[model samples]
Target: MEAFFKALLGEKAFLLDNNSKMIAPTMEGKKLHNLERLLLHVHVIVEEAEGRYIMNQAMVHQLNVLRKEMYRGCFIVDNLKRQGTESNNYKGHDVSNSFILSKFNPVKRLFLSDVDIHRETDLQQVIDNLSNIMEDVNGIVVFLNNYPPLYRQPYSMHLFIEKCMFRCQMEMGRIMAFLMQKEDQGCVGVLPIVGPTFVGKSTLVANVCNDARVRNYFFQTILITAHDINSENISTLKDGAVILHQNNALDQNNERLLAIIELSGDIDVVAWNSLLSSSSYLGRVSKMIITSRSDKITKFGTTQALVLTFLPLEAYWYFFKISVFGSIDSNDHPELQSIAMEIARGLNGSFVGANVTFSFLKDNLVAQYWRRYLSSFREATQRNVSLFRESPYGLVCDCKPITQLIRGDDEFAVWGRYHACPVEENVPMITMKDVIFGRGNYEGEFDVLAWKSHIPPYNSYIVKCVIEKSK
Candidate 1:
């Protein structure tokens, strides 16, 4: 495959430098500024689709990349001016730091492989370049590391044929009406997307990112957790842009609310009013989206707020299978699937709880861990699950429930109580060693089991985010 690509492009596969075979590496981490870092370039030129249907997905997959470049790096798109029936919008981006993805249209044959396609850009370029793959292969390679879109955009609007599992229960009519029509001129209605955790709240936001109309109107995403957004956060979004708020809790700082009022023109609000409210909320053309387990947010916002509900039974089944078994079918575990479906029904439409429960249930269905996870699920329902809480140290825990109510700012969702401990001023940052090895009876400031820290941020923040360990 490398030889074929090399033969097609006639470019030096590797630059001869001091007679050493070097791997072409990305320049993101290597230097503060550099480009043209693509180690291997696959160029296909097509003029005639004759001779063995010369387009194969496997061949493209065999290349250094699976040719599924959508989420890999920078991307750019240019649409040819052929409107009315078929035309794509123009977009410019840092190609050196973007991923390019594509599909085999009727005009072209694409030999792709098991590749994760994120976003497709530049319809004209994609069509023309893909169309020209049979002719000549000569292009540029680059190296740049752009942050992957945390919330992936959806497919092309022009190409949208049907809604998938993610769009279930979302009232497009309501959204389109709210986004397009502006009645009374001073209403920025809110919509609360109610669901348990992981039930596609974030995924819904990802879909919102792809809508061409929405993207054109909005700016960057500012994800605010209960601990993140505050009076300080509003100063950040005061300009013209959209803010994506998540992990919102009522206890977040009042600063964010004040900041919303200060924001300049045309910032679409993608959060619930329960999450935020102000006298000035009416002045902006913002559509607030809130995903929560409760409905208090809707009451606080404009009267026209829409309710984005949970997935229908069918969609839940699809999501369950995908998140669990990696497929949309039960495969061979029909009985387990039935049990899982019953559990979903019992979840009361909380996708988050269902997902968390399913994650453990799927893997440990036959192990002791399965029973423990299931039991935990049942226990959690009775226990009032809270968000983050204040700690003995100055820093708050963003991932655990509070012990006791200690004048918490928004960063710490002040809900419960804890036995306060005065931190000795110069303790660097709490670490796992402090949680386990530090010789002191940790009186209820926080208690997390010894094992939770095995993960990344949790492992790093365990000492700082003290949880009360269960005996």
Candidate 2:
């Protein structure tokens, strides 16, 4: 059997040689090392770009493209390492029935092949991509010093990532540029940001509005929700809107207002027209931002609408991997890394789900615990897919109820009616973590904290949940 394997593998047989494993690194291991170095280099460039106080639109666009390449490289390298580890284990074990292997999609299964001819090609492409991005950004790095630096407290990469927007830099840059534009003497510029539910539209807008540059530009920043705009008193929008920021340094007569309107559905035409006319009370040079899930809002924008979508799968895995490992090195826990990739795939790009799952997994680093979580997660996802013909992510997006198996036959039914409350306001002590991981016994209907935003508009997401007995 050994002779036959050696004949088939030829020069690659060194990868299967257990004796050489202690003395030499495998081909995948070497690629991972090279990729890590490239990732670090790209990260430094991206971080420097992020620190500059101002960047031209062209530079911002370039940096955004570079960021995506960095994320793609990370995903490829991580998956390569994961496949390598699994391949070694499969040499002596029969893992054909493994849940992890069974759950892989067609594309993913291709990565698990014994003789993966595309692995080398994929790794090389990632390396080349990163190297090209690094070369392209060298000029941008040189010009970065021209812009003033924003004063920020020193923070680790993970902490910075945790506290700031995940992958909305481009959108933020566009909005900032729009806000700073010199408007026509008597015109009010309208910029509409459109996205689906729970896609970070509110969070993105909140962060951009809270920026120092934006705050210094606009004399007053107001937040207007659908509730604030009544069809009966459409003209009263100026009075009913919530004041987010006010700059007393600016002259009252020359003050410019930044109005952010949040909508759940399509706005009535007459009410919108009346609202636009009523904005004359604020100032002519003032600008308005409309954020809505409906695409109809695009017509209201003076410029092209800034569309937001969930992060790409590769980008999301990088985000999830960092959130899960935090300051710890993922290389130390190869088994956990494989489990994490599976869990991330099961999440279907849900940011809140990533935060919630990572918070729990970070505390329990054991392989057994992680495997259990993955098993339970897969089961819950399959159950939802079978019953509703939708995944958990789809249900969450639609604001529909999702089931989480608690213990044995019991389940936690998370209701669709959920809302975010200010941090200062009263919030539920019970969290989704407690219920999902079976931390405590609870009964009847109660509110559960789904996620708490650490960034601007620091609000806690509360979901109505009920305990159902027997499935």
Candidate 3:
């Protein structure tokens, strides 16, 4: 969705650039400045609209329509500028930068060269078309700034952190606190780790799972990755490294079991239901941990949803150094370290790039060669499309809205998609309406009504969120 708006803005920028060269001098300086100002306004509006586009399809359609109208206006201006000029001078120059995407690939040709703009006269038609196109663009800018809409944004990251995993220390502590907390006996707990793909959900969970405390707290643990949740796959899950207790809890020696389910957005509700309903799993006194990109899947967490966040730059620097140089501290290689940091800045928060790029560049220890690679990488970022699109970092970075959710100001949705689940006849159907938000008289202070599920004698479960209110 962001890309859709970006491409739109890019075309508009390209057209505005063309007009600046061709028409700037033809009109008054003030008029040219106004055009430039309008162009800048549109760019800002579209960039702001990126997050809003996720939930509103109609907004996208309107923007696309406005984009076409702008393009048609550009086409007319190009034609008008070409009138009576030599064929060679204006043959393809007008369309040169207009059609070429930053990555050097040509986007689909959406507009035709031949357009019929009916007018009372030739001179009048050109002026009218240009005026109308500008008016349409202005109208679009106003519409976007005034009325913002939202739609769902999709997300799709690497590295091994030998030391502190960025800002995950607190997150690890939180999960551990929940898992190790002394609570109702025989009650099962669920922790869902949700974030965009390759944003280190698995790594964070793996770190937590392998924690000495977690291992000691649970008697047995199962780590299940995506697409490996079928009965056949899950039965085989425990066949390898699992340590199952042979006795029941009544023996006073039975141990608790932990199952960690790693998932992506593609998993369906049916698969989730099947996984949750597994007789061997979801038992009293057992706990489940889930990791996925979809917010919807967090509904199964039972506790508050754990939304993974991007590492702070300082933390990411240490992570990158460890991921690449292994214990060879950056201080040892001053020059190389400087260039590495420069390149790392472009990686945003993607651990995927830190690991993969290091692997690719690991062969060359030459300082000069590393500098050259950094230079090219930086240039590509400016001149071309995202080079890391195939890599986890690029995939996540390309989807800016998800990046915003993880690291931006937007609040991540911890709960939604409530419907009735088949339970005993006595259990009432739970609907979204049952879940309510309590008002806050003070700023950032709020409360919510959540459902609680018990186990046996208590037969209810209470879902919670980890939001910190300003109050």
Candidate 4:
């Protein structure tokens, strides 16, 4: 049969093997095609799951697993595509190791230890894993339709991405399930959310509280900050707390209350007990959510604690790409996309850093400006890591100064003890953008708006900036 086909087709017959199966020119091409298909399948499944108003505990867990695999697949495909571009631009160059190592931060190294960029078998294994996950998701898709649909207002894709929670869908679903569940009489549910500083613990609680389903299910919602908890006695906490949502129709004793407490550190045993004791006065069947940076607070929860960590490198890159190139096709500008990937790697999964960097990069679409920004950012990051053994972002979280050479030989010190104020309050006119890009002329220390949150409980972050004189 092979001889006959070869004779009939001549040279073109080389496209088929002895078995008459069409041959792929390269394994990379085949993997890309498979990854593209798998990505589409996982995306559809995730979208369907997200649209459902309710999901059982098992369904939520399954969806979470599927979503994570989808992120991993995206990371692999993105790296492959970027490499393709580089290979096309410069033939016969071995840049795989450096390119792959650039994406491996502390968090990514922990999760992606098995993935070897140089090994074809490892890449094939990731694709195979994704394929297996798709088979499992088939069962989830069938049951997704049984759940009711949620009504959401129409918004542009970029706006929706900016406003909604990024990758916390499963956590949100779990919390929603906990809130809507029926409990025995006089049994108040306590949920503790723990994470590192600025890991979106407060934002998560805020988004959950703002959900229409959560708001309607509970009669009243109250907010207690660390200040409110410390300044006022536990008994008077009710009076001092800010009522976020209240339904007057429910009687005082019968009201279902949700109290969201934000703490900077761990709460003492006595203080926690007193707070729980005081919750009775609010209503019956109350739910308390405590958010803190300390894992020690996890002991206060009635159920398992929800711990949040930095987003995986692949997932963070996905978000960073969307935010930086809003309504712009990245494929059209391969060079800029490459530069953006380098910048994203330097960010170390810091959402605030991504936002601030994108805010500046979006203003200037030229390659020169982006290259300059990436250069300076890399220098600052290297300096921070060398001096403090931490990334600039890590230093910022610890409220320590980070050094930056914004332009020329001029150096500047950015104090990390930034203050966040409600949107209604007035903030400094000079913003981080102005300071970072050398837009403003300031003599001494002054506060500048770092970044603003677009979602509920909107806040403006203000950081202090000081100009360092050259020695």
Ten contiguous residues minimizing lDDT sum, candidate 2: 106-115
Q: Tens digits of per-residue lDDT for model 4 on 254-321?
A: 67889998999988887877777776655563688899989999898999999999897878877888
lDDT of all the models against the reference?
0.32, 0.76, 0.48, 0.72
Query: What is the per-residue lDDT of model 3 for residues 1-471, given as tens digits with 9 covering 90 to 100?
Result: 335556766776786676466443534333433434343444344335443422234556555444333333333322333332323432343323333233343221211123224311433443444455455555555456455443344311112223334435456667776787665665567887888655667666666776656766676666566767665554444553233222232333556777777675646666666666563543434777888778887767679988976654434554565456654644355556555654565676665456546754555666667755654454334322333233223443444211111111223212211212123424433321232112222223222222222211112212222222211
Cα RMSD (Å) between model 3 and the true structure?
Answer: 23.2
Clashing pairs in 4: none
Q: TM-score winner among the candidates? A: 2
Please report how far candidate 1 places residue 409 from its true position, in Å.
36
**Largest lDDT belongs to which candidate?**
2
Ranking under TM-score, best-scoring first? 2, 4, 3, 1
Tens-place lDDT per residue, model 1, 1-471, is 335555644443333221122323433222101111231232121101111111233332322122222112212110010111111111232221111222332111111111113212332233333334423233211101111321244332111211332333224434544544443544454555444333444445445544455444443224333333344444333343335332243333321221122111122334333334532532233455544544444454554544455544434443454455543334244334434543453354444344335435555555234333333332232232322111211111122342321122112111222112223223335333343334444444443322221111111112234334342
- List TM-scores for all candidates, in order: 0.34, 0.86, 0.43, 0.84
lDDT of 4: 0.72
Which stretches of model 3 miss by more than 4 angstroms?
A: 1-166, 183-186, 226-253, 266-274, 280-285, 321-335, 360-365, 379-392, 396-471
TM-score: which is higher, 3 or 4? Answer: 4
lDDT score for candidate 3 against the true structure: 0.48
**All-Cα superposition RMSD per candidate:** 21.3, 7.9, 23.2, 7.6
- The residue-by-residue lDDT of candidate 2 on 1-471, one tens digit each, is 224323444543433344234423777667666676677667666766666665687877888888898888878766766766764533443333354466354323422432245777878788887787777655776777688766466555677677788887778888888999888887889999898888889899899988988888889999989987767776566777889999999887888889999999888788788788887655553788999999998998899999998887789988899888888988678878977876787677887778778677987898767766766776677677777877776688888888877866656565555678889999999988777667788888999998888898998989989888763
